[model samples]
Target: MENSLLVETISCTDGSLVGIATLNRPQALNSLDLEMTRILDKALKDWSQQPEVVAVIFRGAGEKAFCAGGDLHSLYDTMIEYKGQPASANEHANRFFAEEYELDYLIHTYPKPIICWGDGIVMGGGMGLMAGCSHRVVTETSRLAMPEINIGLFPDVGGSWLLSRSPGHTGLFLALTGALIGASDAIYCGFADHALARDQWEPLLQALQSTPWARTAEDFQKVTDLIHALPSIELQTGPLESHRALIDRICQEYDLERIGVSIAALSQNEDKWLSRAGQTYMNGCPGTARLSWELLRRARHMSLADIFRLEFGVAVECAAAGNFQEGIRAVLIDKDRQPKWEPATLEETAGDWMAPYFALSIDDPSHPLATLGR
Candidate 1:
C-alpha cells in the first residue's frame, strides 16, 4: 500500500533532508489500518537512523481531515470474529494496539524534531499521533477530540495521559463528553502548540526545506522558530474556554457518579454547546465513560510507558466485551447511532467493575510494550 503512506525525502538548503510521511487515505480521512500503521512505524524508524534526516513532518493528504481516527471498520471486523474472547484471544486487536502504541511512544521519544500538521479532524488515534509530536501545529480548520466514549472505547493512543494533563478538570470533561473542540480549544488543552492559517502549511514546508538543517537540539529550536514565524490565524473562542468555569466545576467532584449527573444535566442548558456535550455523554457507552474516567485518573501518576501498557490491556479487554463491537456496529456498520452497552449505566459500572480491563490479558512475561521508553 504505497499509496497509503507516501514517504518522501526533501533536500534542504544545507544538503540535509527532511522526511515527510503523508497519510494518503483522504477518502477515509487517513484512518490508520494495520497496514498503514506498519508503514508509518517503519518509515519513522528508518528516518530516525538517517542522520541526514533532520526532521519529520506528518500530515494527511486531504483538506477535510488529518485523520479522523483509527481503522474502526477493521477493528470492528476483528471484534466480530472473536466475540466473547479475552483480549489475549483476539490476536489482531492485541497486535494492532501494540504496534499503534509503540508507534505513538516512538513519536513521543523520537531523537529528532517531529512536526505534526494537525489540520481538520483530529480525534482518537489521530490525537495520539499528534500528541506525541514535538511540534504540534493546528490550523484554523483543526477540530480535535478524544471522542472514544462515542465508540465504546476510552481514549487510547496515550489519550489517558494526554487528557489527564489538560488544565483543571477539562480533561475529565472531555473524556466523559466526547466534545468537539476547535484549534483554540485544542491549544488551550495543550493538544496543539501553534495555530496557523491552513494556507501556511505550504509556506511552513518551504521554510522548513530552505532552512540550514542540523540534526541536533538546534534543529528542534529552528523548527519551532520557523513555525512561529508563519502568519498566525485567529480562531473564534472554543467551547472549552468559554465553558471552562462550568466544566471545571462539574468535573471537580472526586466521585464519577456525581460528575456524571452534573455532565448529563448540561443537556437542558440554554447553551447549545454545553447541551450537546451533555447529550453526547448521555448517549455514550457507559463502559467507555467508566474506562475513560478510570484510565485518566490512573495515568495522572504513571509513567508514559506504564500508561501505554495499561491502555493496551484495557483496549484488548474492550475488544472482548460486546460494547466495543456494538458501538462500531451502530456508528459505522449500521449507521444507527445506538449502542447497547453491557453494563447499561454508569451506576452499574461502578467500583471494581473496571478491574478486568486493568488486568493484563496476555500470558507473556514481557509485556508487548515493555520496550517502550527503554
Candidate 2:
C-alpha cells in the first residue's frame, strides 16, 4: 500500500535511464491520491539529482486514462474534517497543496527533460503534471481539461500561470467552462507539445532510448530532436482553432458581468461544443468561476514559484470554505449531480468573502516551498 508498484524506472541500453513514474490506480483511473503525490515528490527529487536519469517519462497505468484528476474523494474527506475543526489554514490543505505544488514546480524547473505521455482523461492534477514537463505528448484519444469549476475549485497547481500564457482568451473560456479538449486543442492552448497516435507509444519509447545521450545542454536538444524524428501522424484539428476569433473577443471583455452576458448569449450558437462550454459556465459554481477569472488576471506576470505560493493559499482557503467538500460530494461522492453551492449564483457570490483567498497567506523564509526554484 505504501509503494505505488505502479511507479518505476525504465533503464535504457545506454548508460542513461528514463524515470518512468506511472499513476498506478487503474481502477480509479490513476487519480492522484496523497500517497501518489508524496511518492512522486520523493521519486522525482531523486531522479532530478541523479546524473544517469536522462529524463523522466510520466504516464498512467490504464487503457482509459492518463489521469482523471486528484483523488477528490480523499480530498473531500479531509476537507470535511477541516470544516469540523474550523482551524487555521495550516490544518486545512497546506500539506496537499504544498507538496503537490512543490512537485509541480520541480517539474517546471527540472534540469533534465521530462516527457509526459498525456493521453485520455488528463484533468485537474493531471494537467499540473503535464503542464510543466519539457516534452508533452498527447494522442487523438486524449481528452484534456481543467474541470475544477465543476467541483467548486479554481484551477490550481500552477493553472493560473499555464492558463494565462495560453493564446488569446481561450484560457478564460476553459477556466470558466471546464470544457474537454483534444490533442491539437492542447497544443493550441500551449499545454502540450506533441500529438501522436496511441500505437506510437512503444515506438516513441524506443526512439527515446536508442538515441545516444550525453549529459549536457545539447543532450536536451538531442532528446527533443529524437522525439520529433519519431514517426507521428498529424492530429485531427481541434475546435479551438476555428473558435479563436470569438473566444478572443469574448475573453477581451475584462468585466465579469460583461463576459458572463457575452458567454451566455454565445451558448445559443449552432455549434454544440461551444454551446455546451457556455452552458457549463452558466451552471458551474459561481465562486470558482470568479476566482479563476481573478487568478488568470493576476497570473500574467507571476513567476512560477510565486504562482505556486499563491495557489497554495487560495487552494487552502477553498478547502476550509466548505464548497470544495460539498462540490466534491455532489460530483464524486454522492453523485447526485447537484451541488448546493452557497451564494448559488454569481451575483450572490460575495466578492468580499472571496477576497481573502487572493491574499498572501505565507511569506516566511521557513515556508515549505520557500526554497522552490532555487
Candidate 3:
C-alpha cells in the first residue's frame, strides 16, 4: 500500500460509520490510474457489505481537483506498446476500461448513500463517479467538463448516458466543444446536486459525523437534508446558462453534419467563451466528435450498464487505432498540442466510418465486462 486510495471510517453519533475514500494523487489532480481504480473498487465493495458502514464519501486530496480525469499518460504508453494489435489484443487497454467502467457502474447502483465532494476540477472519469453518486456537492471553485474531444477520445465512463439526459441540446454542445463549466452550470446541467463553499467541506464532514443515522431507506434522505441545510455560495449564471438558446438551436438537428456546421459558425460569436468553444470543436478530432454525437443518441434509451459496455469497446478501439495515441503524444508527451487525427476533417468522418467502433471488440460471453448489468 501506497495509500493512493486512502480509506478511513468516521464513527457516526449512532455508532455507525461513514466510509471516506480520498483519491491521493493530487500532483496529478487525483487522476484515476489502474491501481487506484482497483483499490477503490475493492474498498467500495467491502464497505457496501459492512453493516456498520452507513454511507460513503469520495473526495480528492488536493485543493486543485477532485479528479481531473483518467490516467492518460499510462494509457498512452499502453497504446504505443500494443500498437498494430487488434483492439482485444491490447489487453491493458481492454482491462483498464473494463475495470474503470465496472467501478463506475458499482457507484451508480450502490446500496448506501454516496456523497461526492466535487470541490474542484471534475472531468471525464471524475464526472462519471460524481454522476453516479446519490449526492454530489460542488464548491465555488468547481470547474467541470468532458474534455475528451481534446484527446481524440469520446467521453467514456458513462458520460454518454449523462450527457444524453442533460437539458435541451446542451449536452451535444458540450460534447463537441469540451467547454468547461463552473458550479452553477454543473447544478443547472444536473451533473451536481448541491453547491457549497470550498471552505464548508470541514463543517459538512463534521455535521455528517455527528448525525444519528437511521440505518434504513430514510438514511439517504437524511444525508440529503443535512447537505441542504448547509450554506451555499452565491453563484452567477454560467456561460452555458447564458447561451442556452443558441446551443439548443445549433444542436437541435439530429444530423451530425448540420450540427457541425452550426457549431463551427460560433467561432465568430462576440462572446469569447462561445468563440473559444467553437474553436475547440473545430480543432478537435473528427472521429471523436462523430462518436460523441452518435453515442449520445444511442445512449439516450440504453441502460447505464449497457452504456458502460458500449464505452468499453469504443475505448479499446481508440487505443488500437492511431488517433488516441497521436492525441496523447501531442497533448501530454510531446506537448505539441497538434494531434494529426485520421480522417482529419468533419466532412471525412461522416457515414459508416464509425461502424467498427460500435461493434463488439471482445466476444459476448468472453467480454471482460460481460457480467456488468447481470
lDDT of 1 by residue, 132-158 (tens): 999999988888988888888899999
Per-residue lDDT tens digits for candidate 3, residues 1-374, read: 36788999998877899999999999989999899999999999999889889999999997899999999998888888888888988778888888999999999999999999998899988998899999999999899999989889998999999999999999999999999999999999999989999898888888888888888878899999999889988889999999999899989997888998888888989999999999999889999999999899989888888888888888899998888898889888999998899989888888788988978843378777888879
lDDT, candidate 2, 139-228, per-residue tens: 888999999888898999899999999888988889988988998889888989988888888988888778778866677788779878
Alpha-carbon TM-score of each model against the true structure? 0.97, 0.95, 0.98
RMSD of 2: 1.8
lDDT at residue 175 of model 3 (Cα atoms): 94
Q: Evaluate model 2: give its lDDT.
A: 0.83
Error of 2 at 185 (Å): 1.0
Q: What's the true lDDT of residue 43 in model 2?
A: 85
| Candidate structures ordered by lDDT, highest first | 3, 1, 2
Q: Which numbered prediction scores highest in lDDT against the true structure?
A: 3
Residue 349 of candidate 2: its Cα lDDT?
62
Question: Which residues of candidate 1, in runs, are more than 4 Å off?
Answer: 361-364
